[model samples]
Target chain A: MKNVFRFLYELLIGKPEPPMETPLYRSEIFPDVGGVSLLLITLVLVLVYYYVLNHVMRTARFSHWYHWLGMLLINAGIAFGYAIYYCRLHEVTPDSYVYWFAFANAFYSALFFFLFSLLLKWRSYNAARTPF
Target chain B: MAKLFIFGIGGTGARVLRSFGMLMAAGVDIKADTVIPIIVDPDTQNADLNRTVEMLKSYKRLQGVAGHDSGFFKTDISKLADMDTRGEGRVKDAFTFDFGGINQSFKEFIHFNEMDPDTQALVQLLYTQDNLNSPLTIGFKGSPNVGSVVLNKLINSPELRFFADNFRKGDRIFIISSIFGGTGAAGFPLLIKNLRNPNSGLQNAGEISSAIIGAITVKPYFGLQTENESVIDSNAFITKTRDALAYYKNNLHGVNGLYYIADNPDTPYENRPGGASQRNDAHLVEVLAALSIIDFMDYQDADFGEETLFHEYGLRQDAPSITFEQLYEETLHRIGQQMVKFQLFAKYYKDMIREDAGKNYYKALNLDAAFANDSFHKELRHFLENKQWGYFAWLEELARNKRSFAPFNLSTQDLNLLVQGKPVSRSFFNKGITQDGFVVRLNKEERNLTSEANPNRKFLKMFNHVTEDFYTSKMPGI
Candidate 1:
């Protein structure tokens, strides 16, 4: 147990050690907020995330792999940890409905914004075509 | 000889031409007048062009391309036509080439020495002020009124062609302009598209009518701030540039590679100067783009390093007030913000596919219309995969080396060091690219380091092959 806690700490700092037990430790960190707040935060996060991710794929070509890869790894670590916490660590554990509804809501909202940004400017929120 | 008829006389087009002009003035150092350029601005070049040529001319002609291509108290584009029609040597000479192009791609270049007696006499008369800009019997969408008259008179008839017969195949001809305003933006594309029917550029010389063409377009820097912009929208201009490229692809029968320039303008104009100069650095943008196109198309070499258009393009100012180094540093900060955004997106991927399904996630990002679809994931993977023709390849080729799309590579720091007139550090560089350097920005302090004579001759330790004396000469050949 001591060794497993040490492994999880190392994963956060970006070390060369194996992560054999860290995933399990991370499972305890997820918190499945029951009711409306969980849904609201998930919805907001999904839309914001979708917009940003697409922007990176389009323009991140300007720098190095670490610039992008480092960011991706950190995000995945947090979200996946959150997933484990919600499904296994908190409350009586989430049913399949929790996973399905949360996932569908996040994906749909994000996708809508992603398409909208392409057709209009976000700053002015103008609907005019970019002319290209 | 490949003759490239570039269309689009806006900021994008003019900046593209500057690269070709700089190469000509700088002289790439290969013997035999290699490539020849013919300029056809619907009017005259703008203040930014006049100033750049003024600077480059010092290395080649300092006082500027001189008598006719003069800067300071310059003549307007409209009056040049009157001068050309009136046997005014400066105006007529401004439009004609003194020698055969380094290559014979321009079909109707109006070669004078090779003509027979009667034809020579006709050619001379055709070249005179009264003939060249004569109006056309039947006008098109953007015809120059008197210029058309002169063109019809010189070509003898609207049906006949002069440049077509003069051009030979595979000759590299570079057409340059800036698309934001004036002659370059309006005239460059017309000159390129018109060449297809064999009536463009006076149609005066030989028998080969058509030749292959290529283009290098330029986009303004992200901030692209301008104080004196008349009718400009930097965002709309970017979109128009894309449409123009698509237009070239759809309209022009044949064109090879469309290179781009996304750099700051390299000029001395600042808050003090107000001689009708383009504040957004549009001219410098056009030239950098032109240089990239020539290197990619003419040389078939494409591993260009990151170039910062704002800071490194000129050695004029002592220490620039607003250079590309700061701009690049800011750019990286923006990229960092984007990383946070993408991390948030991982949640969407989580519900859509399994943890092991890297392939499915990538597909959903690239090709799919829906966020969770396979195409979108594929696209994300394609970028992450760093495939041969993926986004990385494009970024590496165009932006990683220089903020501007100039052929040579100089990081933002390197650019700063060069501008400071400091020597470039080759110790770590000689050992090979450091892993961390993959995202370095170019600055202006390293200005004259790349052009110096090395004492240790240790440059080979850094670059596999050095970019030495690779510029074309200012002297033209027939």
Candidate 2:
């Protein structure tokens, strides 16, 4: 999981911010941000949109393509903010590479959100055909 | 699988049949496998008859698209001519009986001009000058003496013979006519007499003679406006009803079940004898009279005895306006929920379908193109919202007429307060019945109805399920 996160972030933004911080970036920040923000948090937002708001509460107001897009944007925003917060918490070298990594995380968060929606929306009563 | 042949005899009969058609469109339960409505009005230009025919045609088209298993349009209403399985083409393929146009005056029709001197003297004594000169094209003009003689020839008509030929032993016959008018007051007894004659030479005369025959004679429910030049006088309605009752008590036989209904006259309708102008607003009496047809079909064959069973409708309490709570339990059981469901379906179609273009259920069925281009949707729209004589217009007529039957709060846009006396209970968490909730329920029902292949059938079935859920969950004490 760590190598996979390292490969995804590096593929988008190239190397880490400073040559001295490369090991910390690969060892902790990449995996921590990618797993929590992109995969886990995106999955949770998709489930809340499809299952909780639609099926459990049975609301049709949010069962639209635009509403789904809004949820995806929100997940991306959360990923962007979490990546910046995690990087600062680690006291990494202040550079443009950290911002680039957060940008990559936000982009991947949107993709994961779309993937999760397709997987979980079929069983939703009100939003099954939404965003089609 | 017995069929019910309904003979609607005049203007009142046509209006009652219209109400019955509305009920059948709402998926109200009827015991018969098929219903054959034979409208028997000689006034071909009558507005009431024309409107009933048009509504029945629309209903037949929708029923063709949505099969019997779907809740709405569940019953099959067939034309009398369609019953000829052999394709004999003996009768006209129409809802009304072919009268062949009685274009002559009554005097000319009876051949009084060619009578001998002694016969002419007797005819002059029996008929007034106005009665003798009245044209047959407009109808009897409140004169049953002329109608009785004219309608007696009905027994020899080709439609009667065709009806007799197709009637099976288990099938039942129902007749609807008013006791205060000319055509119905005169035609009802003649029809009963002919159908009861076992020796009548028709093919299945024996079966038809012993069949379970029911008739609802609607008494005077509305009066005519006073017109100095008009032959129909409002003052004579009670006298005519009294005379007809006396005649019916002694001479109206062969009916296994006889039902009588009436209401006090409140407003006077225009005194148009019989033409396109003679259209009257629908009344509660007609709707209840239509219910009698359903009630008659509910009885088992063994329920009928040698004596003719008689019935009269009475409300729980007499009021100028009636709601669901005012009806008896039996009446409510017969039609309450079905009417409410159909009304919901109609209201949604009229008010919310346009806004629901992006709904899951709407997109699943591709209702955007269907609503814009499909004939089924167009017919459904016409059935519910047409300005002249559609379902909403029928409801409005009922509400504005004397002794109003306004059970639904039609003017309000709020779905929670739809039923007049039975409002949906709402809570902080539960908005009882909103447009959003309706769409949600419809989406759920659409998923459940995936197995129904036809879009028209699925549309009706989906609404049926959704409205049923709303009725059960949202409306309490219904």
Candidate 3:
């Protein structure tokens, strides 16, 4: 799972920015941010969209393609914010590497959101055919 | 399953058949497997007959796509000519009985000028100048005397022979006519007489003579404007009804079930004797009369006794306007839920379908393309909302007529308040019957109807199931 996250994030923005923080970035930051935002949060948001708002709430109001896009963008924003907060919590060197990693996380979160949507949307009552 | 052949005679017959078509389109449970409506009118230009014919044609088209088991247009209504599967008969391929265009005067029709002097003298004494000069094209002109002579030739007509040829042993017959009008008053007894006559040399003479025949003789329900030049006089409606009743008491025979329905005239209609301009607003009497057909079909073979069964309709209460509450349990059980469900289906199609284009149910069926291009969708729209003779127009006319039958609150957009006196219950947690709620039900129903291959059938089945669910859950009291 950790290697999968590393490959996905690094594909968008190459390896960690500053040379001094490469070990910390590879060991903790890459896996932590990618696992939490790209996999966990994106999956939760997609479930919330397909199941919570549509099925549980019994509404088709938010089942449009644009609505799905809005959920994806929200997951991306959360991924960006969580990366910055996690970097600060670790007291990492205040450099552009943290911001670059955040950007990479945000981009990968969108891809994860789309992938999760395709897998989960079929069982939804109202959003089954949505965004098709 | 037995087939029913309904013979709708004259203008009142046409109007009643229109209401009957609406009921069938609303998915009312009619017992007959097939209903063949044969409209008998010499006035081919009569607006009421033309409208009923058009509505029946549209209904047949919808029934072709909707199928017979469920949904709108579930009842099977076929033209009499279509029953000629052998393709050997000369019956016209139309709903109305072909009169072959009666374009001459009544005098010319009877060959009065060629008659001998003594026979002419007897004819002159029996008929006045206006009666003789009355054009056959405009119909009997409230003169049953003229109607009787012209309609007596009906037994020999090719249509009657064709009907006899196609009729089977278990098939039944129903006749709808007005007791106070020209063509119906004369045609009803003549038709019954011909059908009951064992010697009538039609193909199925024995079967037709012994058929379980039912007839609804609509009495005077609406008056007409007094036109000095017009041959019809509204003041004479009661007098004519009294005379017809007296004649029917002795002459009318062989009917297993005879239904009598009438209403007091509250508003006067324009008295155009005949033709396209002589359209009358639909009355509650016509709707009730249509119900008699359904009621007649409800009976079994053993239900009828040796005597001719007689029936009369009465409301639960005498009110100026009617709602579902005023209807008896039997009437409600027959049509109430179906009518409400159909109204909801129609209102949704008219008011909410365009906005619901984003709904999953809408997309799953690809309704956008179907609505724009498919003939089934177009016919459905025309059936529900056509301004002149659509289902909604029928409802509007019924409401506008005196002793109005206004069961649904058609003016309101709120689905909860649709049924008059029966508002859908709501709670703080559960908002009753919102547009969103309708879409949710529709979306859920779409998944259940996936096995239906045809898109049109799927669309109708989805709405039919969803509306039934709403009726069951939301409007329990109804």
**Candidate 3 Cα errors over 4 Å, as ranges:** none
Q: Of models 1 and 3, which has the larger TM-score?
A: 3
Across B1-478, the per-residue lDDT of candidate 3 in tens digits comes to: 7899999999999999999999999999889999999999999999999999999999999999989865778989998888888886589988899999999999999999999999999999988899899999978878898899999889999999999988899899999999998999999999999999878999989999998999999999999989898889999999999999999998787899999999999889999999999788888999999999999999998998779989999999999999999999989999998999899999999998899887898898888999999999999999988887899999999988898999999899999999989999899987888889889988998887778888888888888888898898888887
The CA lDDT at B448 in model 2 is 91
DockQ of all candidate complexes:
0.01, 0.77, 0.85
Q: What's model 1's TM-score? A: 0.33
Better of 2 and 3 by lDDT: 2
lDDT of 1 by residue, B1-478 (tens): 2333333343334334434443332222111122323343322323433433332222222212211121110111111222234453432332222122122211133444567889977755544432233222211112222233223232332222323433455544444544333333334455555554444454433222334344544444433335463223343555555655576556644333444445443432243111235423323343345445434443431322232112123322322232323323432232222221121122122222232122211221221343345332334334322333222232233332223332222233232132212223445324222211211100010111334343111111111111111001110110
DockQ, structure candidate 1: 0.01
Across all candidates, the chain A TM-score values are 0.26, 0.97, 0.94
Residue pairs of candidate 3 with colliding backbone atoms:
none
The C-alpha local distance difference test score for the whole of candidate 1 amounts to 0.32
Ranking by DockQ: 3, 2, 1
What ranking of all candidate models by lDDT puts the best one first?
A: 2, 3, 1
